[model samples]
Target: MSEPVVAVERLPHALDLPLPAYATAGAAGMDLLAAVSDGRPVTLRPGERTLVPTGIRLAIPDGFEGQVRPRSGLALRHGVTLLNAPGTIDSDYRGEVGVVLVNLGAAPFVVHRGMRIAQLVVAPVSRVRLVERPILPDETRRAEGGFGSTGTGVRSGTDNGGFPASEDREC
Candidate 1:
């Protein structure tokens, strides 16, 4: 096997701390977050955004991909999550890593620079080739529909099948 070619950068302010890395072999991703106040976290106002730095950028090799995801701790505790959760950083992208976070909880959270905001998981990617087709597949019970299109029906063994059987049921 050949050595993986990945480029990394340490932010000027990241002198005291080391760049994020995984400890175990199964750890395909590393936590990329900042250390804010003991509890306060970063907050994003409605329709507003701030570039929350991850303090590093990677040059993922071809045939590979980088998935930027929200750190579980941040999400569960603060309701702060990546606006574009699992955002893809393609191999060709050469930009400083940033997680676009949004505050979905009722209260605002404070985000300090150098705080760990998200994580980056690197994985292998396979390219799919497309072939032109004159006609598309015609039909099926759930074609082109979503959310609850299959009759909004209940599960096979469920009593009501997810739909009200009568008008008096207050469906």
Candidate 2:
């Protein structure tokens, strides 16, 4: 097969980590297990938790991190959500990559082969600086009121807080 476009480094394992067919193009944010191995993805009844393995560890370059995100199809259909969603694996981390997933659905949900459980995106990060603060000026009328304090008023107010939480038009 052809090589991938992104710059990535593979780690040496005690045994070779054979790439799953579905994960060839990329890790595709998920891994398939030959059998149900402990901590290698399991189904959960209501209020159950399981871990899904990626069978790989990366030597990420400096100034970058690998973010593990939930698969949209899995979340929408099964109501399965990553317990610690969008978990980050730092450049310095050398451990195996895995996702902590939970079934939020009322019934048992299975995590089967080729199920896109999570995503891995390598991105650059910024180091923030800290400063002691003096009182800042009011940026807007809704300066302090937070967490749904601003009602959803389309024709009446500046923000409607539209359904499904529209990301655009941040106040």
Candidate 3:
């Protein structure tokens, strides 16, 4: 299938920087570069957070949204990551893209101009209509079980689907 076209506009401050692009043919997200002004770098001390601009605005098509995700290498190497992971850019948004980065490592991290700070992933969105009802209609064997309800090890003969035998009640 042909790729969908997204309209992107580089702001005045980012005229010298290249547009966001995928590093590999099979990559799912495109690298978003930092557009720090005047060639100055922004430093994030440990436990600090800041909003870094991309200096670009996107016109995402209807029925899709832009997802700003953190780069794994930054998280692994420097303990730097997006404050709001998978930051959502709605279709109606028309402002410069910004990334809220946080430093969780011991040392300070620096964000330089044209640095790949985050990634942009365009994905399809589903709209749903809500219909209120008195009660849910269906039931399952593991209904209502959550947060470690599932056992971590292999089930033994005495295992009652991750719950105690006495707690195995129907929904």
Candidate 4:
């Protein structure tokens, strides 16, 4: 499939920082940088959350949306992660893209200028038209069952019609 063209606007403060880009040919996301205007680092205490600015805006296509995700390296090494992983950035939005990062580690993490804080993944979006109906248009064997309706581990019963049965109830 062909890639969509995303128009990115770099603000004055972010002129020195590199624009978001894919690290590899097969990468799905573009690294978003932290545009610290005054060149001062932002420190996040343990268990604290903050919105880090990117100083850039995007003009996403009408049928697409930008998904902000956390960096796996940061999460595994420093416990820093985006509060709302896969945060949605609608196409209509024209403001600077900011990431809500939280520190889940025992020590504080410092966010510096041009640091790769998060990633932006542009994806296609589908708009559904909802119609009121008394019943769904489909049916399934596990209708209305949720949570741990499936067995915790290996099971030994036929009450579920070959499907895993809940702890005390048959499928």
Candidate 5:
């Protein structure tokens, strides 16, 4: 199978940095780099958030969307992650890609130019034709139950808002 080609243009500040690319053959996302001016670094204290620029514009084909997601290693090690995780880039958007990063750890985090701060996953977009109806199909066994509708480890008989009153609470 062939990969979809996405057109990209690097802005002036990003000329020295490489374009987003997969680190391995089996990787599902392309690493997005931080394009701070002149390869400069930006520091973020704990609980601080900033918009880190990618300095690149993309031409995502119609029927596809770009997803900006946090790197697991950064989140697990430093508690740094994208604020609006899995931020969506619409197909029609032709502007610079900026990552909204937040430091959730006790110490400060530094973002340098060419640092892999996030990943971009291009996914197919399926458009649906909405048809509103007063009534829908028959109810399923777990209809309308959200959140912890499924039972937790402790199997108590009482319904914890999610479980039905008469239903069995067994896991």
Candidate 6:
């Protein structure tokens, strides 16, 4: 299938920076760079959060949305990640794309201008209608089971706090 086209406009602050692009042929997301206006790095103290601007606007097509996701390298190495992971950019949004980054590590993290801080994934969105109903039909074997309803090899009778035990099978 042909790739969908997304229109991107660079603001004055990012005029010299390259547009978002995928790092590999099979990558699903395009890297989003930090566009700090002053050409200086921004430091994020531990337990702190800040909004970093991308200095660019996108014209996403109808029936699609932009998802801002965290870079795995940053999260694993520095405990830095998006405050609102998978932040959604609706098709009607017309303002600059900003990333809310949080530092969860013990040390401070620096964000330099044009640094690859996050990634943007354009995905198709499904519009669904909600219908009010008095009662819903039973769906499946796991219906209304809530969390930890499926066995995870945890002693079988103890509370798992809705989390799968270490011995849980990989999905």
Cα-lDDT of candidate 3 = 0.89
Please give the lDDT score at residue 20 for candidate 6: 98
Cα-lDDT of candidate 6: 0.89
Model 5 C-alpha lDDT per residue in residues 1-171, reported as the tens digit of each score: 677789999999889999999999999999999999764699999999999999899999998999999999999999999999999999999999999999999999999888999999999999876653333345555655557865544333323435334433233
RMSD (Cα, Å) of model 4 = 7.3
Ranking by TM-score: 6, 3, 5, 4, 1, 2
TM-score of 3: 0.84
Q: Which ten residues in a row have the lowest lDDT in candidate 6?
A: 152-161
Clashes of each: 12, 0, 0, 0, 0, 0
Predicted candidate 3 versus true structure: per-residue lDDT over 103-125, tens digit per residue: 99999999999999999999999
Which 10-residue window of candidate 1 scores lowest in summed lDDT? 162-171
- TM-score, every prediction: 0.70, 0.64, 0.84, 0.83, 0.84, 0.85
* Candidate 2 backbone collisions, by pair: none
How well does candidate 5 score on lDDT at residue 70?
100
The candidate, 3 or 4, that scores higher on lDDT is 3
TM-score of 4: 0.83
User: With candidate 2 superimposed using the best TM-score fit, by how many Å does residue 134's alpha carbon deviate from the native?
Assistant: 3.2
Between candidates 2 and 5, the TM-score winner? 5
lDDT of 1 at 68: 89
Expressed as tens digits, the lDDT of each residue in 1-171 for candidate 6 is: 787899999999899999999999999999999998665889999999999999999999999999999999999999999999989999999999999999999999999999999999999999876654333444455544557866554333224435544532323
Query: Which of 2 and 3 is the better model by TM-score?
Result: 3
Q: Which lDDT tens digits does candidate 4 get at residues 1-171?
A: 777899999998899889999999999999999997565899999999999999899999999999999999999999999999989999999999999999999999999999999999999999876554434445655554557765554343324334443344222
The local lDDT score (0 to 100) that residue 69 gets in candidate 6 is: 100
For candidate 4, the per-residue lDDT at 15 reads 92
Write down the lDDT of every candidate, Cα atoms only. 0.70, 0.62, 0.89, 0.88, 0.88, 0.89
Candidate 6 wrongly placed segments (more than 4 Å): 152-171
- Give candidate 5 misplaced runs (Cα > 4 Å): 152-171
